[model samples]
Target: MDSRLALAAVVCAIVLCATPAALAQTVQVWTRGGRAYSLTCYTRFEVVPFYRPPNATSLVVAAASPATPPALQPTESGVSTIAAVLLVMSCIIVVVKSRSRAKFEMIIGKNSNRKENIEELLDNYGSLAPKRYKYSQLKDMTGSFSEKLGEGGYGTVYKGTLPDGNPVAVKFLHDLTSNGEEFVNEVISIRRTSHINVVTLVGFCLGASKRALIYEYMPNGSLDKFIYAENSKITLGWDKLYEIATGIARGLEYLHRGCNTRIIHFDIKPHNILLDHDFVPKIADFGLAKLCNPKESYLSMAGMRGTIGFIAPEVFSRRFGVVSTKSDVYSYGMMLLEMVGGRKNLKSSVENPSEMYFPDWIYRCLADLGSLHTFDMEYETEEIARKMAVIGLWCIQVSPNSRPTMSKVLDMFEKSADELEIPPKHCFYSAIQ
Candidate 1:
């Protein structure tokens, strides 16, 4: 009985500690035949002892229970998870913003360094350099960019008057990312040139975010307008055209030989040729010009630099030949043909598909007919046209070695049409092929 009573006490203590408050309250104890037993009684029971020993006692130890609370609610857990996610996202955003700001600041610093280098280059030239104007001064001169003269891929040209009342064409470059290389090229090349046919650079403007080149204004505008116009009021006769062609050749000759540093005008097209009031042709836009030693026959170019139609075969493909002054000669030849025909050298829409390439068509006409009688003209005009056509063909040979120098080109212009021989047909055939 003593041992049984001790076991009953131990079981009761365990039930009070281990069971929950609701179950502990329903614990029941009973004694039978001097033995004590404990049970966790609930609303339902499988069996009950009906026979009780004589003088047996029953004891029920009940504890008051409080309302049970859930271990963890769904809403509370969900809110905690969302807060943790938000905290992680915010940290990521801050890191990304900091990195972006650092990158932008680095780019600005590099651009600033480049601008300083350009300014130093200008300073080095001293009195020899073209006059420099402030960005504010340019705006005032251009009347807040009110009068736009023209716009191209690089920038816009505005007509402005200098303090001396001399009219100037201010070219405002829009692409700042180029780091002012084009501006530097134009200034370096044109400043060295002093000729009636080479357009003069009067001044320039450089700022933190702006760049411009000021040139002597040509009242007659570019050469393309006169050549390609349909019902144009400005009419240039064949003799005047021949004179213009000779003047351009002279300018090219000067650039190649007369200057201390040989300036190769890589881009020589109708659009780049400007005319004065008296209709005198001047070579303009030295942005693509390259300065080289007169002794160097070939130039090393990173990539093709001239317009598509005017780019020499060698400039685009190393398989043809090394790039040289002959490349400029090729461009001049294409432009000369355009001037003669009053149409582009390569045209998609033509009466005959075989005549699609103007140079080939002109070659065939010269070969078969011995004259450009397809277009009605006087004998003198026809003679001049035939001379220009033949000269153009000589300049645009597939192999650069075959093309004449600017000096030789000038000599060819001086000679009569009968003096010049026709270029090889195989040369023209290979060019078209």
Candidate 2:
């Protein structure tokens, strides 16, 4: 025991005296019959500094190797899962934003193209262009289409007012087809005429789907109102009726010969004739008017036009005659006869079924001039009525060639009532009979 204590004392002194580098190095100090001791025994009093055995350095290194911490395994897996989820979310956000941007750009491009096309159209119209109004202006003028005046096949007519405080009529055409033929026809036909008898086109709108036409307001509206309204408050005298008749004749004559081109109005009727505040007749609704060179006397049509009762026989069947301005004369004649009798020409409810047709009965009365009183004869207006009947007979001749020109019709109006003779019964009269 004493020997061991002395040895430990010496070893302790050596350990305290040795440099740090020396202590860290492995040393071989074997004593005969000595037991092995570990370097970790430095903290215990029972252990003395001991020499390393063979291969002891490797053993120490192997034993000191650290074990992996269990806490880190779950943390690593959680971090990996969170990273994958973030990557997927980022991808989704990018795809959604890209799609939205593409759609927005496409819409903007379409709007730009449409605006450019409308601007180009307006520019092409140039000096000859009628007043062009914006969609907003039309809405303001029409008060959001509040007061409707009438509606027809083409569109609805609304009452409007201008900045100058002038009341106007606005016709808003329907967008029935991609080809706007009716709108074009109405604008072109009326644009060429500056006559007082024609309805004046004040302005027009061509904004998007809202195509509209502006015209001077006719306070008295269409002539059909007075002629067809049995309960009309204002009863027109014979003089006034005759004046309206002559005005319509002059309007037709103007269309036939007055302009540089012969404008044949395919549809002519009381509904199409508008009257101003002073009762001056103005021809309206020129959607079917054809503009032809003066030398062209006939027009070939692909289809029939004009109202059923007013359309000339030739218009429906080629066997009657070639279509011409005379077709309008036939329509005018029918309208004139209706105005004279204050009833429809083809009425089926006549007291005498034998005289159901107006023209047939009128012809029989004219054949015997003494029977004029049978026509509810007012002595003062009998001659005026007879004169109109003679003119009507001349206009409705079966052959288009037999029909007089509109100018001749005007001259016939000035002739004395007795001098006007009834037109002879032709194929047209026979067909009706």
Top model number, lDDT: 1
lDDT of each: 0.74, 0.71
Q: Which stretches of candidate 2 lie over 4 Å from their true place?
A: 1-128, 175-189, 231-234, 288-302, 427-433
Error of 1 at 216 (Å): 0.4
Candidate 2 residue lDDT tens string, 260-293: 6777787788888999998899998664333211
CA RMSD for every model? 19.5, 24.5
Clashes of each: 0, 0
State TM-scores per candidate: 0.67, 0.66
Displacement of residue 232 (Cα, Å) in model 1 is 6.7
Which ten-residue region of model 1 has the weakest summed lDDT?
A: 29-38
Candidate 1: Cα lDDT at 207: 72
RMSD value for candidate 2: 24.5
